[model samples]
Target chain A: MILLAPWELLLLMFANFFSRATCMTVGPRSSMGFETCYCLSWRVAVEANNAQAWRTVPAQCVLYVENYMLGGQYNKDLDVVIEQISTYLNGIVAAGDGKDAWVLDIDDTCLSNLLYYQGKRFGGDPWDPSAFKSWAQRGLCPPIPAVLRLYSRLVQGGFKVFLLTGRDEEALGVSTAENLHAWGFVGYERLILRGPAYRGQSAVGFKSSMRKQLVEEGYRIRGNVGDQWSDLQGDFIGDRIFKIPNPMYFVP
Target chain B: MILLAPWELLLLMFANFFSRATCMTVGPRSSMGFETCYCLSWRVAVEANNAQAWRTVPAQCVLYVENYMLGGQYNKDLDVVIEQISTYLNGIVAAGDGKDAWVLDIDDTCLSNLLYYQGKRFGGDPWDPSAFKSWAQRGLCPPIPAVLRLYSRLVQGGFKVFLLTGRDEEALGVSTAENLHAWGFVGYERLILRGPAYRGQSAVGFKSSMRKQLVEEGYRIRGNVGDQWSDLQGDFIGDRIFKIPNPMYFVP
Candidate 1:
């Protein structure tokens, strides 16, 4: 049971409204505010440019990024969370089996383009999809500073690193890796991407399912770091969780 | 090309010796003085451990309690890595096209008892499997410190944490969860354990095959962390590799 920051709660509210209005479909758990809002925010967040602007945008239409977008800082709490993670990980390796490991997520947890949809005079309110695809192609957006350091250190420590993103399978190859490299992140032997829909429908359960599969293969996940509540729901082998503030936005 | 720390290099030397003498396995290329001492060290390290004089040894084993095992360390570098992950994940979610995910591992990476054998004075030179099993059942080990903090932070951040352990299927129930909880590690919705050996032979390509299965199941792993090199050799969807130190030792 984790508490959400005020801005995160507000963003969720906006996401709920936008989901209802846009008629977007997301994985199961459609029962209420979180799921729907989660979906809508992804669509909207990509169009935002900063946290403040995201706060200003309405839940309806979102503007498109006209050019390559990059750079922005998240809430200050981000540092505290990262520090806590570093400490936890150090303990695990020092005390537990000195194996290599760290669990990670791609969406809101790793990237920050969701702030792009904020306050821009868009086609409507909230955000739009067409504009975001173009922005992603540029791969210029900046990453969260604290988290970046964590990943880099893991690599430096000789621990095997893995990147588990829920992005489309199509985004594999140069697009995803290049984007990560551009942001000064490295050392991923594998870049797992989302596959096609399962059982004729999209579902958030996919992440969990995949996580289970990895366990069967013999990886001992030491730490799991992500932004969304769903990101932390799987069976990770770590002791604690590090959650940074995503007050400026939300995602499905 | 990760640079091994001085201690790590020394551990590799010992690992190479043990692996060659006991398993007759090919040593990792990265081990120092691979050609000359590879085979000799294997026999020597094992004999050294078995020698009566070396009853009390400090072995490189993972801190595995019941379920959760600690990863290791909180340093400045890991912070930057997670920050980059946050950036990519933010974009993926903003697109409303991706999902959230993290990859994990078991065995030395998660729950480990290898150190118990090395550190404790078991009789004889070469290690005995029975002694290792006895140590696991005893459950006297602690969790890795830094890894625990990472797990806590990730859980707090809202990501779905999945555990990927290589423990045989028989090691389930209270023992599993209890170990994790006791060590201060979190549990998962799904736990994947090793099925029976194939045709009485252990399977090849450890974690990679499982990661492939997860991809087929539609998971986009943004972070994949594990202690063994095999954990990072998979084809999953991890954008970064967060590795922790495992000088306590390695298994072939």
Candidate 2:
């Protein structure tokens, strides 16, 4: 049996509480004069989601995620994640000759906004941009341990590492750099964030162009890792794509 | 928040334990002479499993599902399910004349193997045929609460109900009948089971033939409910199909 800590168990129960509440609709329906407590279609979807081998959350459940990052389930899941990533990185290192690089996504992958998310109650309140920028300016966000370990090791071993995030550089240039430096993450070839001109662009399109430019500059991205599909959906997706888990809120 | 009884919480956890344990591989791999703790491919699959919106479980985790059927999750999910089933049944009753029937796949649909699965630990051991037969012979399987309620109401409202199971008639006929009667289920026109001659047939083939026979008898199947893909896959899938959650085992 997987040994979960006592608080971990509580955290799991806490995390699941959100998913269970996904289908709770108002009003009991009277079917042929029989009063029923739940909505049939939503209930079927809930059960189907549980029963299927795989499931995408209902479109509605994406915004209400309450405790995904706070729970240990997310981190424990990532432990298995980085182990596999380390294995793959080691393979690419062995197989390549030279000039190999890796692409990394910033938010929720390299740096976590655990505290900010806690304050936001995992997306219950509408997103406030000024508050987010103020939070970013604090540079208090921490490096995810597994990703930090992998990145530091990769850089020290002579691989060119690039930070490719969707955050706009005009908005977060110095703050983003300081945030990375504040958290023991340093020494990357380029910390590429979106330019002001690229505002309102699709993540897939922007990231793809950034990667294309990198490839044209003769750098081969051996691996790409991120939490969102948009981060990995574009064309120059590299030799391997390691997706970090982030079910709290969808970027797209 | 959804209210979960203590035993229900335990049961849900017990059910989930099966799916989680499935993907823990037997050995560590040598990636470029760096010994890894587990199969890197499998570990990658595990991470990928967590990353995707919906996912077919890694072959490893199907048996270790943690909280799928307990903690009020299952029953709460079913509320929506029966609502939909009732709607479809009501539609048939409104739209059609008489001779309408609903097809129900037995296990995990019309009748539940909740106790048997609980006792067996959701299929942990190598399946023992003799042990299973002995368990089935006891005929204590309870009806699934939501399905039983829908069925009884539909039957009382004048729609024919048919029980179509994959179990062999010679082996489970009396036991299945007795079990249904124990749950206050009676007066169905037929309880169809796979005959000895259909032993080598595929489920889709067997079920298809059964439905064909019923259709030839001038019966109009209004709806069908099941827990597996094969149960709803063939030609005579009827007017509507409702699937129940059963990730414990794939029947086909």
Best by lDDT: 2
Over all chains combined, what TM-score does candidate 1 have? 0.35
TM-score of chain A of each: 0.61, 0.73
What are the C-alpha RMSDs, in order, of all predicted structures?
22.2, 13.8
Off by over 4 Å in 1: A1-73, A94-99, A119-124, A171-173, A197-203, B1-252
Residue range A104-220, candidate 2, lDDT tens digits: 999989999877867765545556678888898777888899899988988888888899998879878889999999887888889999998779998989999999999999888
Model 1: lDDT of residue B88 = 48
lDDT of 2 at A214: 91
Q: Write the per-residue lDDT of candidate 1 for residues A54-82, one digit (tens) a residue.
A: 33223332221111111111222344456
Question: DockQ for each candidate?
Answer: 0.01, 0.07
Give interface RMSD, per candidate: 27.7, 14.3
